[model samples]
Target: MIHDLLLEREQRRTISKLGLDLMITPEGNIKVVEINGVNSGSSGVRELTGRDIDLEMITDLAQNGLPLFHLGKLKDQVFPHFVSELSHQQLLAQKWMHPRAPQKTARFVLPIVPESSDILEGIIWNADSDYYVFNERKYLLINPFAVEHAAGDKSRVHALFQGDLLAPLRPKMAFVVRANKECDVSDFKPNTTYLVLKPTDEMIGRNVIVVPTEDVFCPDGSLKEHPLAAYRRREEGWYQEPNVIMEELISSKKIGSSRTGKEHNGCMRYLILVESDKGEITIKHYGGYWRLAPSSIQDSNLQRQLVANYSNGAIPEHISDDDLAEVRKCVDTFVPVLYRRMLRLPINDRPDDLPLEAYCY
Candidate 1:
């Protein structure tokens, strides 16, 4: 149901790989929250080893420098940023690969310079540049052109509410707002309830705030400063970003959930879509987990952690079997359609590139 949002080239530079985030309501509705890239999922090997497991990628890049390309000053910014991140990772890998031990106990001794190897050769949309460098170089990104114009945007997803197929699964209402203009919570149904506010471009639950309609404004009747203003101000000075999302806060229904019988506020379902050699698409059920809201909204110490973004490490350990299955079914049906739309877009620069066809099931 997503549509395109016009953006300038500089604004589009950060577009990377796709990791769609979805919320499962108590009534069994599947609603898309947002999309992301370079989120907090580590590979199985990295998890087991407790380290970045792709030393071969670093060795190859340093030994045989691959062609680096970017739009405008991106190359200047991206190249150095990646080199520093990779260099730090490489040093750690080198340390672990060699240890002061008996010859028999020593792991395979890696040389000062790593041997070159071939990695995946393809472009990754909405990718994290630094993370990509240590992961693998074979999948050399074609840069700039591969980024889908507005792939992971909340604005684009909000516009999709009009589509018939998504209407049932979507939220009752949502809209965009800027920092300068305060939100009119009275427009939403049950004006007495809370509303979900999120910064459009931010990820990892950085600036997501769930506040009651009345609490949003100050005692003096002026709009309160953003929840993230202090932190963001320290980082980039006093400038309110003009784009934020305001949506009807869907109160998650209590379920006979968890082995402990304690109720959770809500849950998140993560789904992934991959393309095969013949341009076939496959939707994989990645992971589903529960998320809890703040216990006391009035307590300033309590923060409403609405987004269950993996990067923020907001995973709930317990979920009932039925809840998991229902979410899975919804994801299996919904993701293929999303992938099909993605395939229709021009996602590659190579002539041999093929569009994603039917779902592989």
Candidate 2:
């Protein structure tokens, strides 16, 4: 479903690569919890599985070419731009020293240097010359705006799930409301035991509040303090109501880790690559990895076991052959539906005025 949407946009001037964080229920149902665009992790998968997906990606790019980096002609020149509020020195150090740094394995691409980077609307400019500098080597920046729309916000995903195409694949959402507004706790589904409150665009499991529905409200007909604390810390004032999605909490199936000999609340990260060539589009499953929650399922803290995210201290686990086969079967079932839906939908969002050329440096 997401691949088709991304492909339509890629046919225009936009391109996207996806990393889906999925929760596999105890019943073997696959539910998508999050979709990451260009900022998704490939290095971590390499570190865990010893599979160089980055190399595969670059190889594919060279042959087919993505929207911005045409014909893989500039594959060697393109650099992954990391956007954050960190200081220039700090960012540079991370790019070079981080254990999972892409430059360590994907040597074709150079690390980014702050001195040569010039921030623009969607593209980065090299202040000194046409080439960007890192370790005294020159490279080009991938246009950030080219993949911006591919980064689906939670609200967008929620809205998409409202349609029949993706409804079955998404968890049951209770309601989507602005954080500052007074939400009626009674509106939640009667039988729903647990609910997840998540900010629309926050990543790495930040600002996500998961609690039992029964504890959502105080006895005196008021909202509980714990759930509201994340929202209150915003400096944008109380009236700045960002969209918050309240969905039924999907319990992660327990997977036993061979290394630890313990069962853990786990999630799966499946990477999907969508590439557009001369008017043709292709989609491929670039393999996947499993993430075990920081604590085991036996942990006393329910919240700690619920969020299985790498940034939140979760670690990667090897996916056994049996587990991989099961997931592949599920994904195979889902892909055809996605392709059928893509064929039915008209490409309406592509900008006709823009040239169908790569955004080269």
Candidate 3:
């Protein structure tokens, strides 16, 4: 499903890498919960498994005669530093360029700047001139516009890309409330037992509110107030400032650990690399790791059981070959459909707002 999304984006822009946060339901269904374009988990996978997946990614691109440029802010501290060290050890040439720095050849650009920031100080921007910047540097600039357009708006991407092949794999969205709009409590149907309220652009489980329609009970089974009682009543402080996406809560399958005799509700992080060379696209599955919920399946806290995210103190487990094979089968079945859809659409028929220069090759 993600490969098709990448292919669709490639028709207008160049995007080489993408990550999908998947949830396996009790019925053995794979749900694509989130799509990550920038800073996908090469580093986290390494940290969890002691495998240098990022280095493997670099080697793969290098062998394919493709040089990748890492765009990020140094102050962010994690990815930029890790990529710098990895590139240095690989003997790959590296250079740092500020947004206002004179255009120069560089394999890596530190401190990723805004898309509207000046690429060259005191010079009128020219695509022709900027083309040389990439060509001369012998590297592809991971376009910020492409990243934002493709992954920033979660609700938009889901709406635009649904098909017979994708519809089953995606979680059902309840509704979308535009930025700064008030969420009408009535919009949530009474029969809907569980729902997820989150910002459309946020990642790693931040600012997520999981609401259960009925009142939740304490561990002792005593009745407690519902989590969103305030929101339901439209309390004074309750306001949805950013675009809020309401999705039906899809419960994860319980993963049993034979060695420990315990079970967990888990989420998987699958990374995929899409390389475009001479108009032919190649996709490689980089394997994945499992994030187990902090508490076991027996825990009473539904929030912890539902959201298995690394940033939220979830435990990382090495994914088994069986699990990888299952996910691979789903990808194999869906990708061809996505590709055919792209092929049917003529390039001239693509959206007019897409930047012409974004077609990297």
Candidate 4:
């Protein structure tokens, strides 16, 4: 099941790398919260420590100038290829390699990619569709398209797991509009019940809001603009905001160094690898990380939202092996279903794998 899913191809090439964001609920259920393409770069270290800890900058120290590291099929094995950034000096040095005495001072040439075409590789820290389109033979650490499918939409991605597989891992989520044609205001609780509104395409938890459903509509039965809409920053700008996916609030136990050690809401992150070879796929468990918070998420105030994403002051912590075992079970059921739904393929389709019910409109 894993092999067929990973090895499936579009056109003539297989997806090489994928980055996923997994979350563990308060009740200890594991769920996939987001997926990222190869274009995903780690800002965890930077955000956690406030330093330029990019791999490219570190690798530049070896005089290899930012070469791409290809992870082998086996974990822990990596291969390096020289791909250097473009520079004016290098361009001039190439132009006047045999300069006469009039231009004898051309010796300041820096190390660069031997082939000009590889220059693009230096500019990219992670693989994207463009990276695969440009270099087919290069091995990637993960597949790019899988990342897009997993992280692209909140409503769609969460809907896929509404059934037995990771169903317990999911919170109460739904696609909601400003005015519900069927749902009446009586069904909403003014302050006790909270719903998290998330933009479909934004990242870094930008434009995410947690609000009381009652506030979305006015007494005149018309939709009222959410106050956060005016003050929040978004990937596509404020006025151009896309439709949102609203989920009922699920409180998580404290998973961080809160002053009171209160059971504040939090999420756990797991990193794993899916490797493919000769039409076979296998998932390797790398380990698990964490993101914790001191408060329940809120967005109505237009302040920095209380998203548990690492960027929002979430510090990393240790998770035990027992916790990882639970996470593994969720991924085992999730990956195959995710591959099937996203690709519309039956690589490892199971009749029982169908979502228990349609989760969204």
Candidate 5:
């Protein structure tokens, strides 16, 4: 009831794959006071984000072929400015035996390397609380959404919100929308929260419009039309997480799902992204909890060959068509991009790694 269960599962799967926080159950049933989210408004929610370590230094190390451990260790220092503040109070309350406040993990947007024709379309709506970044100057685009004020009467809205009250809401995403803008929303229903991998540049205080889910997905396959439609589809078979289906899709030239018309069904809608290296191109597919990189072999033939190898085969007899369609989305999108910034800077480049920290406004 609180969030999109499918997207939530994908979200949990995503963060776990990236070595982030574990998912908690009853997320919807959880006390409003304890659930983490942003307040809705005409303007939108806005939060600051940055990293502690230097990107140039990290890039330099990478170029020099230095030990990867340093990079990993440096990763610990990277935290979202907004999340750090939220985490601080949560931890303090935990230490003092006080009621714990909801804490949001690091999230953000990264810049698309302009002019680089290689954009991964499957990852346009990626968002994760904890983000990982490997760039010196990176940012994330965020979308704004509303949650019923369940977190205890805004007792300390100031303490929790960290950003200016009249400030806009900004959640990291692959794209950004300005205030008063109307964007396409996915077939996703209203009040239904879906998780995405954080895309990299926030429009900085701007809320992006998303297309409606109904207009987004075809009619028959839409989850709203038939609740069972979105369930995992088994006929598509088990391709495992991060597998790609385009080779089969393009080859078969089929527009429908992986369901054999039996019990198994598949994703109701698909994620459509426009990427540009020399120019922008369109990519469409279901996405979540998976990073499907069609091995970037130099040879185009090899790339096609690699994709074929990764395509899903026939769904298992026991697998429900619904199940296959849902999980199969994992391989459809690009990995979520992370934008990390250190809040408390240290004089020495290396600050003893710190568990994500935060400060109240």
Candidate 6:
């Protein structure tokens, strides 16, 4: 569809050479998915737009610098071609609009999503929603990355589109909020007990997915991060972040490290997992080539032991006294500094594996 957007000749060449992908929404928003062989003459990168271009209106990029659109050919619905962030020099393109996530200010949920990764909460945001940019109906951008599904759920993680957020709910399970459901201030019922929520695809009240305040501090399990993202500088020295550690665990080789041989690089992804009496929990994010503490998960044998027990809803071991002390120290030291997103329980939908009696709001 980008070939039809009013684009410069250079932009078309750049998009073509890389086999890049672009997305246009029914609301006239545009997005760029991937761009390789970036334009060198454009000062490392550049953004092109005519203030706005109608995606359903045009089939080719426009060269006149004016938005080119053929609204007549588009479905009566509005269509956005793509969404890009404005930079002084240019815009970065993306595929489909960045979906919107529900974000409320309530500090209700305490425990949260606990890993570091680029998470995609399917089709949760929109251009015309009640967000910072109200009514304009645009895709969204979540600062930290994450992806979540119902707790204990074993179902397909479908990708939802922004234009279709209001469509009939198609959640794999009963967690979906029907498209016609309506919600107002009364939707948030008071919590008698501290609620714990498991991520689900369904949006609450209506077929709208909201970013719950539940502790979305980390992400839902560990997923692989791109190899090149290991280059951030921390206090100790050049180091990979906790999410990088999770990726190292998933990669073909040590993801963050560019070392030649897999000799004793000694990178391990282990943690002193903490669960609270209140059912709230905290994960001291420490996984890396440079470990801050000894490996709580010494060998694959121990890892297996923990996994087996966790499957049955049990804690693995006492956690060595030294390890305990180190974890305590780490929590005390970094809990305040660690990034966090508080989520309330039972906000989205019931978790499949979680006991209905427990973690209820």
Q: Which candidate should be chosen as best, given lDDT against the real structure?
A: 3
lDDT of each: 0.42, 0.54, 0.55, 0.46, 0.21, 0.21
| Candidate 1: segments with Cα more than 4 A from true spot | 1-18, 38-126, 129-151, 177-192, 214-237, 255-261, 276-280, 294-302, 305-315, 345-361
Provide C-alpha RMSD values for all models, in order.
Answer: 13.9, 11.8, 10.3, 12.2, 21.6, 23.9
lDDT per residue as tens, model 4, 1-361 = 5434323432222332345666665566555556655444345534444533234332442252434533211222232543444243452354312122223343222233255432222222332232121232332323433334445556556656655655655655555443223433344333335567777667766666667555665655354655345334334545544656655566554454434343335556554444443444456554445565534343243223346666666555555577778777767666645544444322111222434232211
Candidate 2: Cα lDDT at 94: 43
lDDT tens per residue, model 3, 1-361:
5345445544432334567788888888888887776456544577676776555655565443333334333223343213442332232233322222343533333344466543222111111211222321223434233333445567655654465667778766644555435444443343346767777777777767777645433444333543344245543453544566767787888876433467888888888765443345557888888878877878899777767788878777777787799998876676444333333232211243433222221
Best by TM-score: 3
| Per-residue lDDT of candidate 2, residues 1-361 (tens digit) | 5445545433432223567788778887778787666556655477686776655654554442222222112224433432223334563564421222243353233344575453212312211111122221122222122232324366544444434546678776644566455565565453457778887777777767677776665555356654555556645454455567777888778888766788998888877665433345455678778888877888888777777777777778877777667766666665443332222222322232422121110
- Candidates in order, TM-scores: namely 0.53, 0.62, 0.65, 0.57, 0.17, 0.17
For model 5, the local distance difference test gives: 0.21
| Poorly placed runs, candidate 5 (over 4 Å) | 1-228, 232-361
Each candidate structure's count of clashing pairs? 9, 0, 1, 12, 75, 66
Compared with the true structure, what per-residue lDDT tens digits does model 6 show for residues 208-280? 1112222211243221322212222213432222211010011111111122222111112122222121323
**What is the Cα-based TM-score of model 6?**
0.17
- Write down the worst ten-residue block by lDDT for model 6: 244-253
- Evaluated against the true structure, the overall lDDT of model 1 is 0.42
